[model samples]
Target: MFVPGTASRPPAGMMIPYTEQLIFTIATQIPFVIFFGMGIRNLISRGDPKALLFGIGGCLASAYEPIVDVMGFCYFPREGNWVAFEAFGRPIPIFVPATYGWYVGGMGYWFWTVLQNPKTTQQEFQLLWLRAFIINLVLEYPPIYLGIYIYYGYQPLEIGGFPLWFPAVHAASPMVAATVINLIAPHLKGVKNLVIIPASVMAYGMANAGFGAPVWLALSVDRGYHVSYPAAAITALMIYTGVWIMSLQLLPTQPLKINGMNGNGKSKGLRG
Candidate 1:
């Protein structure tokens, strides 16, 4: 029932002090940053260039969330809910981008992990989508419950105060990142930092713009909330489903080779 581009004050009773908000922001973002850092290091040390590239791609892709949020295409309503610093014309927490990086990187790593499992069968590919959904719920529900942020201004169907389409959206993102990275990995065998890094940013942007533009437009223009939930949900589902199917097609059938040493710094097989 919220309107895009319109600012709203937090409900009086729900407002938390800036200090508390900062604490929450730091608490949530640090773990993701650490985890992503560790994963990136492991990938790099092992010379698993493919996994490293995709992980970075996911990080870059997720960074777009904050940009869109600040432009008023979406609303976070974090002004009173947290200590805010202005960027791109909106008061947002500093950790917003980091949290997104964590999410996308974490999810990308997850998808990579699943694809690399030696015993995984083609039938198990379907499980990637399921894992994406579960991960989405796990990551989002806590923030919603804590009132860290909430969608406003003409959201679609929701579950427990979060948009129902979110899990699908979240699920689609890593797939898009993975598909882009996988398709381009061969050409990017060397100088990946120079080429793949920028390419990943552009690919992520294009994927989000292509898939998310309709949803954004639908939400933006229909300030009256006239867009039916079913219509919106269907649109989201179509986009996500297409991405999921494309990912299944692009994913390598063979188990991936892990590059780094095991716990004792000893090399392991592809199953590692």
Candidate 2:
């Protein structure tokens, strides 16, 4: 469905063929689904550090959204009043375009959370942002060149030229959001694995699907931008943020070793 904003069609050349896009979609989501399921299992088994990581990563993913929502640049097509939106009165609607940036950002956030464990203190939280930026750079450039994805706002000094700053914008903003979450994680209270896993997973899955778009359109009319696209991107960010913090909270609580006694059945670790 079209939202209440300007009905700018996605860049013509940027649109992948439906069949190919579908294949890519399935390919992309399958691994995430598997990993998230594994994360759920780990969370159920009392504690899994990676599961916690996913949870926290999912949560922090939404950090950049409020600004994007406010900017009127976001919109969608609507049959009714074109100016009215549903996303809680925002100007645009939730759609695929809105979502693409943050989905990738969540992955970047996840990498940083795992690489820099606060327990070790080897790297400060700031370094995590740096690492996330670098890794995203390494990952996104090749894909763009290979036509795996195309960026919309990447205009260079010349018209249609490669924008030097585009990748940096994509990588740095989310990393900054993640860094904020990392800084605040310790101060937040009542963190637990149980809270982390399910919430993070649900948020990511739903949001990535542009969960808010239909609802937003249904509610008001003119809400956000690209009804389905932006919805997916924001969802990814929200999920990442949730999962990232969840990981932080659960990491320290995991047991180093649950030792059972030898054949003697004497106290070995936990049994002892």
Candidate 3:
């Protein structure tokens, strides 16, 4: 249970009662179950399974958590009431992977659908990342504070007791994953659609490594320094890079219009 490179904080007073931690677990778990059901509904009723497969892949993507955690200086308490898996010394909670499935996979799939609309513009795509940033910041703050997971070292844009830089960079990951999946979507049909599952893991792995590398560079340097400014520049560049990558995907084809009308004023609807 003892992790070698684990964060040094978590003062003795930091460990709350397991009973209280269970509340956090169930709270996150309920929504994850709901998301799982939604994925199934999409598959059965809507005749689409990308979301479900990606959700499963997101769960598998959880396997990469410990590596990222250890390298990126993220920490999860080992004393948790539920431990799904442990690697490189860190013990991640069961809710962690559950959230990954819904938040990472579900949201990524949603982005994929949004991008499917040839009408969705580069500017709108950037706005989506902004929305993602706000959603992640708010959603992460509470659990990051109460759930007892944290980024331990030199964070660039630390805010509300949580590092803003991490979320900022993380927001674009779904976009990156979505963009990559859309490339192969046309060829995906029948059993081939199952490719989405591995694609989810592959996309997630590349996205995290690529988008997260900047802050990782700064964090790896500072360790316990906990300063900003210079680190902030790296953070901005990283976010901009994510936006640029997303915007580039929209370049080959131009978007139609704000209203669903293209050229001749014909009504057009978005497809996932």
Candidate 4:
């Protein structure tokens, strides 16, 4: 029994117009689609079934958003003309999940790329985390600013009206993805469709535990459905960072020399 409250509602004049939303939605999705396609194609061509499976797993993980939307944990305002559907009482744009898939899949490919290079050190991992934070700031902040989606129930510590920990959550996602990819790499290389089971579990677990739990708990308190910003923010940071650390711990002690053929194939040696 969570209510998103008024903060979740878009301010007057802030809601994206139907036409603009449609245009933006399509435009944004195009690049991600292209990247995902290229990544998949490259994996296929390079005979890297393990990487391909990881990418597919990432896409599947992104589908968890629909459940979040339906549960009233988050809101994506509708542009009247966009294709719409309902699940668990939530209205969603068709393209929203597609974009999410691209994002997650793209990250999975990135993780695969990182693993393929020579041995990675803690310093390199830190740099990669910084890069993810910056990238999320660039990509995610705008949508929040534009009212593409509103955080209704919980008001975690925010900058520019969005949770401050969001970028960190974004940053951590690839690490979790990397963990999943590396864990299944060996088995997936030899088994066809075997990735489907573990990938499904990881996707669902990560989405629910990593993303959904913190928000849910923040709203569950006596304050009703409003976000306990501090608690929520802390929970997000902890979960995300913890997962990221776990991923790092789980990484291979020695990096595998992946040839340059797949999407993440560019050889960038670990910087000194």
Model 1 scores a C-alpha lDDT of 0.58
Candidate 1 RMSD to the real structure: 10.2
Quote the RMSD, in angstroms, for model 3: 7.4
RMSD of each: 10.2, 13.8, 7.4, 9.4
Which candidate model has the greater TM-score, 1 or 3?
Answer: 3
The TM-score that candidate 2 achieves is 0.40
Candidate 4 residue spans exceeding 4 A from truth? 1-16, 50-52, 70-72, 78-81, 190-201, 204-208, 222-227, 240-244, 247-272
Better of 1 and 4 by TM-score: 4
Tens-place lDDT digits, model 1, residues 186-224: 566556544545555665566566656556666656544
TM-score ranking, best first: 3, 4, 1, 2
lDDT value, residue 235 of candidate 2 = 39
Candidate 2, poorest ten consecutive residues by summed lDDT:
153-162
For all candidates in order, the CA lDDT equals 0.58, 0.40, 0.74, 0.57
Query: How much is 34 displaced in model 1, in angstroms?
Result: 3.9
Ranking by lDDT: 3, 1, 4, 2
Q: After superposition, which runs of candidate 1 have C-alpha atoms over 4 Å from their true positions?
A: 1-16, 49-59, 70-74, 77-88, 116-123, 223-226, 247-272
Per-candidate TM-scores read 0.70, 0.40, 0.82, 0.72
**Model 3, range 1-272, lDDT digits (tens) per residue?**
22344344443434434765687778778768887898899889989888888789777888888877765666776664367878777777877888788777877888998888889888888898888889888777877777567666566567766877677766876777788789898899889988887887777677667767766666655554443446557667877976887787887755566577776566677543
